[model samples]
Target chain A: MSEPLESTLKPGDSYVQSFARGLSVIRAFSAEAPRQTLTEVAKRCGLTRAGARRILLTLETLGYVKADGRLFALTPKILDLGFAYLSSQPLWQFAEPVMQQLAGELKESCSAAVLEGGDIVYVLRVPARKIMSINLGVGSRLPAWCTSMGRVLLAGLPPAELEEQLARVQFHSHTARTARNLDELRTRIAQVRSQGWCLINQELEEGLVSLAAPIVDRNGQTIAALNVGAQVNRTPPEALLEQCLPRLLEAAQSISRLLQIKS
Target chain B: MSEPLESTLKPGDSYVQSFARGLSVIRAFSAEAPRQTLTEVAKRCGLTRAGARRILLTLETLGYVKADGRLFALTPKILDLGFAYLSSQPLWQFAEPVMQQLAGELKESCSAAVLEGGDIVYVLRVPARKIMSINLGVGSRLPAWCTSMGRVLLAGLPPAELEEQLARVQFHSHTARTARNLDELRTRIAQVRSQGWCLINQELEEGLVSLAAPIVDRNGQTIAALNVGAQVNRTPPEALLEQCLPRLLEAAQSISRLLQIKS
Candidate 1:
């Protein structure tokens, strides 16, 4: 498979089927269907009513999901699962104030993310303005090959890992500026590595421009990336690079320094 | 039995054993042990090495965990579990920008949370300052009967549910200021219910002053509580109420309106 590892998880062998199914049940709910009937959830998760019922009832009993005897919706308790991942990561707590200050000062949304598999997951986010059609928040994933933060993070990876990841990537043109091939994508990552930062214009989404820098540790390994996202109309690639890149790189360096001091 | 319902989910009959075990493995990694050896993980998760290894391998296959044959750690893909909960709830998206603006204007941290069982879980946060000793972020839980936001949410609960929750609450004096008895807590909740807002001066933690207002649905149901957290040294009780209460209430009402619009 040319896709990420998430797709390769076997249905029954080596994995816990019930656990995977339970997660599928949770993921079945979205903005369109926050509350669903047992049959609805059953059909979506590809489980029998009895199987779905047990999983739903388990989640409800645990307080992660709620049921009014018929329909089910997630409870706020589910946030704890996400919180566990976040609180375990030491960088976010230290990086939050820095990201917030940068977002505040620059009047742009700032974030930090880590490359995982073939995607970048937002660990920290501070908003100055709403800029995306899709709502992006902490835990939100974006394709690593397209985003500025993704490029910066990819640039940090060892050559062998990077090649393996590139081999698995299924390239698709999200916008006109999206890299159409692995060679082009590698070139972009190379540029980000050489420059110590990256500025991309309308690559991930139309009207979206972003600048990113790697958050390196004392060992000079990039553990994460800091980025500022803006609208293309108000700030072109050159303007984004000139104005936001320095600040983003500075914040990333400061975060690295904080990590160093704490370690 | 005295603990919250979240503690009651067990494997074997009603719940999926593998799913529960998988989540337990995830919960095992915290600030104390973000990275652990397989033996360490198995011991912490109360699993045999073979069992823990299977779950860890399954998680790695599914992109949630990563291993280097000796040590294991969660990747950012784990955030998807939490993000699914968030994106399903429309109130958060509407509440975030408003919370951010209020935090910016008042120069205090603004957050929104909902009561689940005997705990309050944060769903949204806009930090202008860091005032608490323990780091609190989205999905972080605090005792529901102690904090200003918790009291406001408790005040919103039905009488029967409130009593049931109170019965399970392990009330303790975290500081000299925490609620010592249910009677005093009921009085505080009643006051919050009567006045439509609450302000606590160092109740949850020393030097932490917070004001809270309830976000009601169209049917006048208290769905969530919004709060502004400040430090007692910089802002006195009266000063916090005078400067922050109005904006806090305004923001809560605005969030309620947004929920009504979306619903």
Candidate 2:
């Protein structure tokens, strides 16, 4: 598990420690440890057994977690917490039809994600096909330094914040084509910023080729990124750029226009 | 907003009051009130301004909620909380491909939902076309008493629990075809339980016809529901039952088998 970001926060009158810990407990249950015993949950979340027990029971009482004998797991009611975010932002709803159209036209999976810390969290996704070995859904997170959507979102960030985020990344090469160093990544982000779009070729995965464009607000600030992914063998970079990029840009622009009206 | 469920629970040693309150604050933001001021949030969540402010600040610190001047709104990071649920339950992941294929075969919108409180929360949705006036997506909630997926999920519950859930619903007739009273709804639910599938003809919305089957575990427990929806104009009730029912049942059974293997 990644380090608990909450641990860094100094609890004050404004910071609810118990609330933060509850979130930590929720985050502790991941793909690796979906179902865990009390001790396991405590250890993973960096909490005492007593604290974890209280939080777990609280979750159970609220119908967010279910206890199956000795093990505990999150229930579907927990989706309401995520739905709270999706329903609040009408931007995602507006982006969906446009994305669906783009995915149909291009015959590729289309997604929209926003920069969250050092990652991009997919808020909306319309899949034309399963293009990746790793299955990604609405809430899926990918490293911001390696993904097409990531770079587009990163390009939207101010230089100082972008640098800070880059410094925190424990960069490991996913493939030979992935940006190797801080300078290369910065250059790529700079290119995305200049060109107003990004195309990642076999960086995150060997056969994955994706192109991304920014979904901006009224002020032209990029709030989210829109991307389309295909296989390298199926569509070479030339074909992707020539055939798909225009439609991708148009869809992103259309979403941006909708967002502007909504805002 | 519905009555806060946490208010009914007594504050015991195991119950985290601050955590529950924090969740209430999060839930306070919805489709009706996407962004709110401190006073508005406190009023909606039944918290004191100071209490709401602290929780909101804490949420902002965690990157789940963002502050725009005086207004607070949930950020995309909040989806991570929902993602936690989706990532933990491998059922939704396993069910997605099956849903996609079923949607493709039927040329209709396919969905999987689980019973949560008095509602069914959509976990997986694969849309072949925009069939409904309401755009349903993952985390979207619908009344269990009305939706076909809800009826399938409700039928899966033990009789006493099902009765309790039905009693809690604020029953209202959504359409002329909707069951008018408790007895009528009970009869429909009983039929669904006996037949092992459900077909709702324009009960939830006008011109919407939906058929649903339960996705069961190894023990024959309905863990989730799989549904396919189309317009009444495009496909009559007979066609939905004759043509779509077999595919829907096959898909649901296939998912059940996959769940059995995983468990």
Q: Evaluate all candidate structures by whole-model CA lDDT and list the values in order.
A: 0.83, 0.85
Runs in model 1 with CA error above 4 Å? A1-11, A129-134, B1-15, B129-134
Docking class of 1: acceptable
Fnat score for model 1:
0.63
DockQ score of each predicted structure, in the order shown: 0.47, 0.47
For residues B81-161, write the lDDT of model 1, one tens digit per residue. 888889889999889878877987888888889888788898888777433433588898898889888989888888998
**Candidate 2 per-residue lDDT over residues A41-121, each given as its tens digit:** 999988887778778878987778888877899988888888888888889888888887888788888899988888999
Docking class of 2: acceptable
> Candidate 2 versus the native: TM-score?
0.93
Q: Which stretches of candidate 2 lie over 4 Å from their true place?
A: A1-15, A130-134, B1-15, B130-134
